[model samples]
Target: AGVDDGSRLRLRGEGEAGPPGSQPGDLYIFIRVAPDEIFQRQEYDVYCRLNLSFSQAALGADIEVPLLNNESKIIKVKAATQSGEMMRITGAGIPHVRGNGRGDQIIQMMVETPKKLNKKQKAIFQELAEIEGNPIKETLKGFFQKLKR
Candidate 1:
């Protein structure tokens, strides 16, 4: 039931029949697979992107990812996981159409920063920024000054 796109199949005697005593023609079928919403197929491999919150990326957590077979699996995200980091689920991808084994699922992590923070959250971030010395702001300021000069 999981035939890949652009696959071809032939059924003998399934097409239009010849004259009364002649044999029927062979029917050829070309397969075309529809695009999935969550997963993308590359050969036998599957890939998808999972979004993580800032805290989740900074701190480790167990996350659920959907499978191609309508099931979900838990993945352990390591602490300080950065954006664009990839995690692999072995044997969780598309199966080889003509072989016996399956491919792997490659998940790319995307860390999403908070767009709006409450007062308490802002205060905490402010404290953290001060503790970290807010180097990013200074770096950008210095770059802009250099450009102006």
Candidate 2:
């Protein structure tokens, strides 16, 4: 029940029979743990990714994350959360291989931008762009300055 990948078990005299007067060889078995579809393990730590809509990321929301079992937990994503951010849940990962405590679960946040917009959506975005001015122009200016240096 406590076994993990790479664990070996040796069975004495469980191999093929040898000569009449000699002892049989031992049988060694290696353990191989199959990969789970959702979670990825590193040592005792587990990791997964969560996708967030642009509005959800900008306005904050409570999202559900899956556990090792068939359960889930809700985590709060703070407002203005950026893409590629990481959220860690302490003691929510896999149990230690041979210890009393468990590890942590790390979730990577991915913010998705819409690919297609309706007429009203496009109008709203254009208004926002107007209010925000031209960020691309400022970014390009910074890039050119860096290149000149």
lDDT of each residue in 10-110, candidate 1, tens digit only = 99999999999999999999999899889888888899999999889988899999988999999999999999999999999887777588999999999
- Tell me which residue pairs clash in candidate 2: none
- Clashes in predicted model 2: 0
TM of each candidate vs. truth? 0.80, 0.77
lDDT tens digits, residue span 21-104, model 2: 999999999999898888888878889999998888999999998987688999999999999999999988878766599889
Structural RMSD, model 2:
4.6
TM-score of 1: 0.80
Give lDDT for model 2.
0.87
Question: Ten consecutive residues with minimal summed lDDT in candidate 2?
Answer: 133-142
RMSD of each candidate?
A: 3.1, 4.6
